[model samples]
Target: MNTIWLGFSQKLLKVDRYIKKSFTYQAIEKTFAIILPFIIIGSLSMALSSSVFSKQGFFNQIYDISSWLPYEDVIKKVLEIINTVTMNFIAIMTAFLSAKYITRSFKKDEQIAGFTGAIGMLILNYNLASFTSDSNQETFLMQDLGIRGIFISLILGVFVGYIFKWFSPRNKQEKVDQYTFISRGVGGLLPLAIVLGILIGLTLLASMINQMGVNGLFYSLFRLTEIKSKHLIITILFLAFFNSILSGVGISGPLGIMQGGLDDTSIVSNLSYSLKHGTSFGVPFPISIHTIYDSFGSFGGTGMTMSLIIAILVASKNKNSRKIAKFSIIPSLVNINFPLMFGLPIILNPILMIPFIISPLVSMIIGYFFIYFKWMPPAVYNLPRTTPAPLMAFLGTNGHWSALFVSGIVLVVTVLIYIPFVKLNNQAALIDGGDLNEK
Candidate 1:
């Protein structure tokens, strides 16, 4: 078993190196790196908004701040705007940065490529009906321009960047003069036109088909998981697997696709039933995706990343890994793991992939059994996504001690599962002679 594990780790390391060398992967990494600060700030704002400011927030539930806090409404509004620009527009920013980096990789006019990528994203999300209607109002589909659209944004950005690379001249090595600047601008015009034309054509085609665009189609596929069925566990596992894989590739999962648990039918029904029955003990969906995955599996964000952080801090000797884990702790406590995802870069790291995918599924299964056997009630309250992980099940079940205990047990099990993977990652780094403290 040891020999087999070692061989698999070696093969995984090779795959990791190969992926890191790819231009597209490099572009995605740099895009995430560049946008990480915004993600952190946005996460902080979201955490505060959900936990402190909102009437339904965790803190507000504990004690109503609005009754006496000065300028609470104004502060809440400011935070909302901040969250809107930083989080709601993340995909647009991703498009710009991704195209910039990809164009830079090909020595093309990166600034123009970045603009083109952003414009292309906008074009793809453009709704003709919004403009054509007589309401004298324009509506931008936030779903297509926000976290939900990241996968499409990255694809579009890469496409735009490559178009520039194919059509535009390589950047000059020498110092740029006015003539050179004009020449470069003129050279990019063709690529710019080509990319924008393609995007425009696609938009028009989507409109002609009476479709919202690629992202709309993508989410439509996701909505298929919402079908009610007797095979509840199968559906939950499918979602868990799909969400894990998408998140592994740096795309926002379905849970992150819609914040606040507002649109999820199962969550709504569970909450409604619990409220009506005055207890979560026998809610209709006692083992739903929300009751299991969101309540327990998603501790410290997707894949129960808090476990990863704990594993790193406890088992990793790599300075960089330890540093990242420390930095990620606070955010992870609030169920925000973007810093760790991009910084430790679980996105493309094959070494962590197994545990990253497995830990959450394991936790979800444990949670399912706990609720199934009546060891705890299902989490039925609609708490903020930013609520601390261990407390989520407890609060959602309206102070169920057994729910909290189950959550704690799940966290410990996931941490154990991740520890071995974290050690394997450290071993891989040592084998590669990589500087553990580098950057």
Candidate 2:
């Protein structure tokens, strides 16, 4: 083993320094840290979508408009509070992730604490901000405050580094000068102030405009006297249906097109949600890809109708395999449905086609009834499905808690739809190689 290790090390060291430095380690790091693991999000998405579409699904059971405050408002309120808190939470996490990466290199706990504080400021204490609009340059970066998060983290790291260095004797020098023009005297902090001023000024202007412009203008549009009271429910229903289907379409098509279109859930949900909000076309929203893609945005096609496909994949196996399949079922319930689907490649399989095709549509139909009859409200935005699909769907749609029951219903329906197909597919596979080619 030592000879092999030494031999490989010598061979690796023999490579050109420039080529090795640029690609080798960095390339391998990105593959495991970013790419390969990315596929798992796709699987998670499948679990998420299936959960949403199940008749016993979360969307159906969530809080409805009828449950407003004092009665069921408790339910709705919890969802609202979550949505409000998490709107830009992903972006804030991103900044911390960046800070964490930088700090982790030195094995310092202060790195996490420092970035967490800075992330809090950008998220709760500030507004959406930016520096550059051009996407082509390496100079571009963004976070919770949009581009402002990127700039602030750099500046804050410098400022924090200064305070930290002054207090902690081990590290006396900082890299603030990289961001600012000067590093000493009042002039040194001047650049930091300028950046802060711009952010503050832009935020003030935006706030003022909302108060004096769009928000005010829109408030009047929603006024009972200004718009028809009769059309309210109808408008809500249309929007609800459109939003639900639109979400499914995005997750199924563009997002998971790589997974046989509708086979993947994360891709479908995000793409559907994105296109609905016009994010794919450059418009950004609180729940847009700018906030979701890297983390929870890739689970749609992997989950939707795929959960049943997964169960089918597992159910078709031997008793030992069935045990494993049964075990995966519970985890899939909370949006971890990949153990069976990929475990058996039910992606484009002809037998498991039963659930793949029916689950989502059935869920959509059931979900539609809840919205149609005013049992639930539309999902207003995208929330991290990691927080349990029912709960997340409830909050994601802005206190439309009825979405939870609707989602639960969808879940039941998905399982039912898969039952027959799973049995048939299992029998066929058993006759074949018992692994797919035995026959």
Candidate 3:
């Protein structure tokens, strides 16, 4: 088993190196690094707005902060705006930064390319029929301009960058003059036209489909899949796996999409049953994405990454890894792992990918069995997304101690699963002559 593991780790390291050296990966890494501050701010804003200031928030319910705190309503409104701008507009920011980095990678006009990419993203989601309306206001598909549209944003960004690289004239002279600026702007015109033309065409098609009453085709497909699945367990596991993979590649997954202010039918049913029975025990749809994956598998955010942070703190000797883990603890506790995701650089990490995907699946399986055997009640309450992992199941089950205990157990198991992989990452760093402490 040891020999087999060592061989697998070596092959994984090779793949990691190849991926890390790729232009796309490098561009993405840089993009994430640049936008990380915004992500952190957005995360904190969401946590505060949803979990601290809101009337239904865990802390607000306990403390009744609005009654005592001065200008509480104003503060909540401010935070909400901050959260919306930073989080809801993340895809546009990502497109701008990704295009800039990718263009830089090719020694092209990054500024113009970046702006072009942002314009393209906006055009892709723009409602063309808004032009025919009485109101002068232009409408955009706000949903696709946020986290839900990041994958599309990334694609458009990269495509725009490449088009600029291929079509725009390369900067050959070292000296900068007014003529240089003119030449750069002229050079980018072709790429900009091509990108916007393509984007407009796609938008027109989408608008036509919407006119035909085929709205939300992307969301409808997933909803249909959920409605049609015969085996609940298999469906849950498949979503967990699929979500993990998409998240690993830095795209928002189905889980994220489904959970965006839209309650799952199973979750709604379970919640209704629990409310009527005054207990989560024997609730309808006991084993569900909410009860299992969200409750157990999402500890420390996507991939049970909170466990990865703990594992790194316990087993890794790298100073950078440990420092990042320490910095990430607060955010991870509230189910925000963006710090660790980009800081530990888990987005494209190969070694961590193993546990990053596996840990969640294992946790979900444990959660399923725990609910199946009546060891704990199923989750029923709709808690804030920023709620702490251990408390999620407990609160969701209406203060079930057994649910909390089971969540704790799942957390420990996920940490154990990540320990060896963390050690392997340290070893790989050493082999590459990289200073783990400095990295």
Q: TM-scores for all candidates? A: 0.86, 0.33, 0.87
Badly placed stretches (over 4 Å) of model 1 are 170-179, 225-230, 255-284, 317-327, 330-334, 381-386, 426-439
RMSD of each: 3.7, 18.3, 3.7
Q: Write the per-residue lDDT of candidate 3 for residues 1-439, one digit (tens) a residue.
A: 9999989988988887788778887787777776666776777777777767888776777677777988878889999898788878878888898898888778787888899988887887776657787787458767677766766778878898889888886567622243466686788889889888887877777777663111244544554444325877787788888778878777655676655433467777888888898988988688776777788888878899899988998889999789778877767777877777766678778888899999999988988888889988888888866678878899898888998898889989999999999998887667765522211
Q: What is the lDDT of residue 38 in candidate 3?
A: 72
Write down the lDDT of every candidate, Cα atoms only.
0.78, 0.39, 0.78
Given candidate 1, what's the lDDT at residue 363? 88
Worst 10 residues of 3 by lDDT: 211-220
Candidate 2 per-residue C-alpha lDDT over 1-439 given as tens digits, one digit per residue, 9 for 90 to 100: 8788456434433332233243222222221232112234343333433333333435423532243424443544454444334322333443344334333333333343345435434533342223333444322122233221322333344343333333332322444333333323333233334434544564456445443222122222223222223543333233223322423221112222111321245345655764586433222222222122211222233335334545445455456346446545544546454344334334334445435555554555565456546555444444434445444445655555466666666666666766756665555445443322111
Q: Is 1 or 2 the stronger prediction by lDDT?
A: 1
Global CA lDDT computed for model 1 = 0.78
The total number of steric clashes, by the backbone 3 Å criterion, in model 2 comes to 69
For every model in order, what is the number of clashing pairs? Answer: 0, 69, 0
Error of 1 at 262 (Å): 14
Question: Residues 53-168, candidate 1, lDDT per residue (tens digit)?
Answer: 88777676667777878888788888888878887888888899889888877877777889889988888887777867888544566667876777788898899888987888
